[model samples]
Target: MTFPRTLADLSTAELGSGYQAGDFSPGEVLDAVAERIAACEPTINALWHEDLAAARSRAEESGARWRSGQPRGALDGVPVTIKENIARKGVAMPSGHAAGDPQPADHDAPITERLEEAGAIIVGSTVMPDWGMLSSGVSSRHGITRSPLDPALTTGGSSSGAGAAAAAGYGPIHIGSDIGGSIRLPGTWLGLATLKPSFGRIPLDAPYLGRCAGPLARTVDDLRAAMTVIGRPDARDYSQLPPYSGDYRVPDFSVSGLRVAVHTEAGCGMPTDPEVAAAVDAAAQRFADAGAQVTRIAPFMSEELLVDVDRFWRVRSWVDYHGLDIEDQRRILPYVARWCTAGADVPGAELLRCYQSIQTMRQATVAATEPFDLVLSPVAPVAAFPAEWPMPFNDPDQPMGHISFTVPYNMSEQPAASVNAGYTADGRTVGLQLAGRRFDDAGVLAAAEWFERSAEIAAPERTVG
Candidate 1:
């Protein structure tokens, strides 16, 4: 049966209901999604690899199940994109780097395994920066991933393609990873909803500090749905926490009586764009209208903490990249090479010092947030910048300034998300960040849903050719 063009726009829940109601077969939905991807890919560059044939086969199987009076699970037949950094068995996980011999993964990442188990069809692997390092989507291997809302603007990174795919309607659900706001940055710039769940909430095979996998979606409900499936424990990941029993559903509770703190600037002394700040203030007011106790607070980060965190990030990358031979290093992206060199010479004692400072920052953040139910801030100091730039800041000396607000929460290992607050006067998107204490992912998602319902954040008109 032929499906409407809008079939790709359905939320995960809506899509499932439509399948059960026989509105259209899963094959029909897959064909519509393939059309959407073909239409947007040339300009957006959101996907790096696609197996439409495999995806179609999966959809056919799901359609047979639905016709037989049974559906596989919540996400059965859903077209979902996994970020390139995540392994999908038999798919090459180049991660946008040219330095290494690109080998097809022999096993799926735990999250990928779970999503498929829930019957989600893997449509393709999305684009990212080399080593998943940059905040902008410019990659040596995959080219730049532009915003679907405006091709001249960046989609943000290293989950760049996931953001573009989510915004471009490739699907309702996209899997993204965040160490220093990779998911949230792209979500903000692309005008999508994303969650960087508390550390260990989603099991990951990453060896880096502060890295975790989560969902980027068009709606809070979709995020919740994806979380419920991917948040399950995986024995393959040694870092997996004891299984979480907390519900992933957004609570239907009122926003009133919740204590919230609004921070307009980073404690590291980064200045926010006035327009971005205004949007965040307006979001805070929405909470106030809902009877939430909202107070304007200074940023939770300090200059010392920011510096040490930056060092830790650089050294971590240095460790990963340093193992490559000189010839391999030469093939790496220039910006990535610069970051690696910056930390390669650091003494072991200094690295130890950075970890100590990180622990101190974590303690201080937990203490500061203990009294508040939620913390609200701008996801970035500025809206989406030029696609060619590595970051919004022009100075190489201050490369991480734009990520100041979001990265602190990563250090604290807390649950944080980027929600579409509004747009800049120039038509660029701005995101308001919501954070909750560690393991309070539900509260963060619940607050985002309240804002989404109250504000009615609209999806952008297709700007891609």
Candidate 2:
């Protein structure tokens, strides 16, 4: 029943095969994951509300199935973590905000139910900024979720703790939500693999929820496996569409013949770090070397869309708690209240105008890239920012600056992923983003894999085994 060694030692595919072949039991793997979480939680505070007993019980059930020689599902025996904002049955569902009306969830969110059905045990939930507003994982109520690589550095927030937990080897797979680079930014900062599938590829039963939850894993294979589990049509979510559920058999997708658009300025005016630019340029050349036609494209976004997208995101956060009482609001954190008020304060006319603007931008951006199979760019302007300063809030005028490189896809609802392209001289990570047209989740992953294999940007030993 013992596992090989570390949770870091296993991938989602390896864990599944091990269960199928009787190499180990889910109970053992879950136990190892729990132990790792125990060791790392003191520094990372990754787990918001964990029931070790429930995780163990689920693992035991999976172990029983293995004993009978009937594996439960593709993700059988895998240990995974869910973002706290996503409901887990009977768990407290708080936005981590002071002014928010906190409540316990009555049922599992569709994604959670799907993961459990696929035989993946949810070991715990990771921390997020109240309602996922700021880029820093810091919440006056939830404390800070620091990077495992260096405690002083920030783990990209909203999805901060999940990334830190995964990077620290607490689990092979982690589920995170992305609205404005929540999944991609943290993965980039921590040197992990993550996918923000196109809007509706994964279920979002509640349109009010601005972000869609997706997988964050150490390997592309693990991310693919997790995607198979949760990326499906869910009756609960009107936004979810059928998954591109094909075996990731590398299609006759020769890069040499493929057309890839490179966005050097990333459609936003923020400065792209030389390290990140060089890594992405190098990845593009690798694509060229592999036979893909790479062409640099001008910034494809409109200024109006950029402003409106930011407003829409802020409004979503406010709408979540706008109904609460002043007492409830007072209970939430200051920054959460600040953001919600900001969203509430937007002139009614401007709010309507912003919504309409987002639609126009989505169309224009899609039209501009429709000719290319994939678009490649940097994931963030900088590597890992200091944990002390949360992004978008660190500076007054630069509210959306840190996320400039990754937010367009969220606004457009396109499938995008952040692959570890390379690192800087100081050892900070650099991420190359590959974005594809809506519902081309597999294609985006395929492109990322090509870059990873070609660029040889393996996970660092310090972060993983």
Candidate 3:
């Protein structure tokens, strides 16, 4: 059984190296990926629309190009899944809602175009919760995605499918869109290395304050490679930053002399579980042992900021939900429907107050961490919950309680990543959030890679069922 390792289980760098050295072709890798998906997808429900036949043809073409020494770009043959929300041409972007368009998209999203142009094979689109709102994988259109670590446990969303697929060995790389803690929350829960790059680092056709697409994989190297492809400039997004001239590779670097701040208390939302806090403390110690100056930081987030942000998002979801016909409106997930209903009667002045609170949060986050070169915190305040729960608290009145640690960075436009830090008492994985100053994606990634090497970053056992 151990005669040969499955190519699907290889890291992105390993797959690319194998391709360059002729150890294996993209077609062979696609077959291996298909095998893995078949074994896991039925139980995990990690994917929605898949055309394996089309993917294999693309892989064959990529393999031929690789053999001819003319691979299209750096990620030439790697198999990858895009979050269901990231539009793919000719594929329906239900985006975890029944109200979403049934017709195929007319054009690819900017990141999708970039990845395809880099010759990456698109495996399929992963599942997500309604409107990519919830932190758990309780999708309406797509069924719940169980964590690969334990089928009974949740895979945090809105990047639910990408996280599950990455942990379950569907491929070496997967792309996800995160606003708030979507990518990092699930990454931690599923024990994957995920990066939610600084806003605009990965261009989005439809950009928002905290929304951006990023990579979730088993290794930082894969994330680095994904950044190389996804970070390319795309004019379609007017909000995207000017082309980044810096390298995307995680530099061979040291954490020595870095000023790193650690925070366990959020001062607002869900309190960090003892086991989760211990894991974060342990990650902080890793920095201390590596000669980095690790210091505890006070919580800049507050109950007002958390509630305001949640309300602001609720209004948004309410608009989208209300626009749907009555039948389609009823089709929304009950949890999401109940949550967004609060926004319907919201006063305009109160909505403006909510927006201002986001500004307060942004300013507070920057001011609090300005002295440090990097920041570390728990990705989520708790460990994995049941797979079927809509969120950690599962309360319509207060659904965003778990995102306090990760949301500030998104509001502040800082580059943040989640590395599988350690485990809870019962052995569920924990993620440590590494955040750097706004636009310092490279620095954040380099430090994450450094920690990735030092930590025991274990992959889940293959028994997903």
TM-score against truth, every candidate: 0.96, 0.93, 0.97
Give the count of colliding residue pairs in each prediction: 1, 14, 1
lDDT by residue (tens digit), candidate 1, 129-205 = 88787898888788788888888899998899999999888889999999889999998898889999988878877
Ranked candidates, highest lDDT first:
3, 1, 2
Stretches off by above 4 angstroms in model 2 are 1-5, 99-101, 243-245, 248-250, 319-322, 461-465
How well is each residue in 188-227 modelled by candidate 2, as lDDT tens digits? 8888889998887777556543467788877777888888
lDDT tens readout by residue for model 3, 1-465 = 122358888887788789989999999999998998888888999998896989988998999998998988768889999998898999988879877468888999988888888889899999999999999889778878898778899999889999999988888889998889899988889888999998888999999988878999989888988898899788888778888876675456779999999999898898889999999999999899989999999999999999999999999999999899998988899999999999999999999999998999999999999899999999999999999899989788885889999999899989999998988878798999999998889989899988989876665554563
Clashing pairs in model 1, backbone N/Cα/C closer than 3 A: 256-291
Higher-scoring candidate on TM-score, 2 or 3: 3
Tell me, by lDDT, which candidate is best: 3
Candidates 1 and 2: which is better by lDDT? 1
Per-residue lDDT value at 36 in model 1: 92
Best by TM-score: 3
